[model samples]
Target: MLQDHGFDVQMVGSRKAGLMHHEGWPGLRIDEIDKKARFSTPRLLPNVFTINAGSNDCLQSFKLDEAGVRLGNMLEYLWTASPDSTILLSTLIVSADKKTDLNVMRVNDQIRALAKQKAKDHKKLVFVDMNCEAGPDVRCLVDGVHPNDDGYEKMAKLWVNGMLEALRKGFLK
Candidate 1:
């Protein structure tokens, strides 16, 4: 998608999954990424990043109330590590598990508030709401947990809109 948009995209991180490098692994929560991303973030200077986290936290039931603070801390660390980078923060997508999805909604609300508050202090933060009725469901997800190919496609579509929004708002250079 970025290539089609004429933007040269270079995915950077420690792990090599398939053909691209990414900073994430399965079952990672916001706090885990907070520590894990440090290793790659400083070495590879990326211009833009898209973050969709907290699902694992909700699933694992680890520090549920503090997800926002953990996310804010992670964002702060990212900014300090690479001041030139622009971050597009996304809300959690729909979950099939009723209990887990409720937590997803709760964390997503915090994420939304965090984005608004952070935007007042930073111009590079872009808020992208990935939550909606049309999002992934029992059919689209793999075992109703991770996104399947179709779910991934939908995720890319959401991220594309956020990327375009960031570009239009001058958050992406």
Candidate 2:
């Protein structure tokens, strides 16, 4: 999607992955400092950083405060690593189960509130509310977790629109 939008995108995604990687096998790959340090201190940093994760942590039944702390740590790491990078926080999508859906909402609310608050301290911090934008459209999601092609297209549109709004608001220069 970013490729089509004429943006040079560098993506890092793992199968069956969450923002918090388990110990033993992979050993905390998602740790904010570990993730940032993996890039080897490149000269050119990313212009934007969009994070749409943490559903797995919710699925693992992590407490709300723990999730919030983990996410907050990540945002702080990103801010310290790349002060000029615009951080875009995306709300988690809908899940299949009602209990999980509620959990998703709780985590997403935590994320949105954190992003808004952090934006005051770090002006580049922004948020894109995927739940509010996409609504309850099952067609936009495959298996109620991940997005399909159509769903991805919708997500791309949402992201583009959000970025455009941010640009207009002078969040991005």
Candidate 3:
């Protein structure tokens, strides 16, 4: 949808499966960024950067502070790598299981606050709340974390709309 709109988009994923799927799409560039690897070069820069991760980080039993620190470092690296990039940071999605809902919510809140703070400091930063528009019936998971195809499509629509809205507001161009 974004490509149809003439935006040069590239997607990077931490997971191998995501990389493989995105690689098959025409005009879609996919890069695999290993969490354990050093952050050196980014495939896309100074245009748009969107992150749809962190569920794994949470599920891996990372403490809140650790997760924040890791995310902060990644953001810093991205910004440092491409200062002019329009950064779109997404809030974490809610888990399907009610047992982990509170944790997910907490992390989402932290991410939102962090994004806000980062935006205040960085002129090009834009925070997008993916969780806000996702209703309870969105069926956002296949297991209890990863979004199903339907959920992903919904997310994509939300993101496109959000980007358009941001563009209209002059938050991004």
Candidate 4:
């Protein structure tokens, strides 16, 4: 989308697309950087880093506080590695079940608070409230866990809008 708008865009994913790159998608740059490996040194930084993880982490039956701590550590690593990068943290989207939803909301609140604190400490850091932007009704999966096409589209729109808004606000130039 950014490429369509005339901005040079590069996509570095957690895994390689293998033969898919041979199809000639110039904008996509697949890398082997794992989400858990963001803490390492000499990190390859992008202008805008959008993290859409946590749902899987939450589904693993780990403690919420532990998950938050791990996530916070990852964010800290990203901030340290790319001090100038605009950090856009996304909240985990979960199923509509009341119990699971509450857990997701709790985790999201922690992330928001963490991002707010980081923003105060470093002006380059900003939080995008994907949970609110996507709306409560839009984040649900068919099994009340993973997102369907409608849910994915909602997420994509939220991310695109957030990136544009961040750019306009000078978070990322």
Best model per TM-score: 1
Q: Which ten residues in a row have the lowest lDDT in candidate 4?
A: 21-30
Model 4 Cα shift for residue 160 (angstroms): 1.2
Highest-scoring model, lDDT: 1
Q: Between which residue pairs do clashes occur in model 1?
A: none
Model 4 spans with C-alpha error above 4 angstroms: 17-35, 39-43, 136-140
TM per candidate comes to 0.94, 0.74, 0.73, 0.75
Name the runs in model 2 displaced over 4 angstroms: 1-44, 133-136
Residues 17-75 of candidate 1 have per-residue lDDT tens digits of: 99998887678888788888887888987788889999999898788889999999988
| lDDT by residue for model 2 (63-142), tens | 65567677787766666666776767788778776787788888888888888888777568668888875644566667
Worst 10 residues of 1 by lDDT: 130-139
lDDT score of residue 50 within candidate 4: 75
**C-alpha positional error of residue 63 in candidate 3 after TM-score superposition, expressed in Å:** 1.3
lDDT of each prediction vs. the true structure? 0.85, 0.65, 0.60, 0.61
Cα RMSD, model 3: 5.5
Question: How well does candidate 3 match the true structure in TM-score terms?
Answer: 0.73
The best-first sequence of candidates by TM-score reads 1, 4, 2, 3
Per-residue lDDT of candidate 3, residues 1-173 (tens digit)? 87776666666533346343131121111122323223433543445666655665555445755555566676777767766656667876777767466666767777887788786775565677777756323366777766788777777776786677557657655
Better of 1 and 2 by TM-score: 1
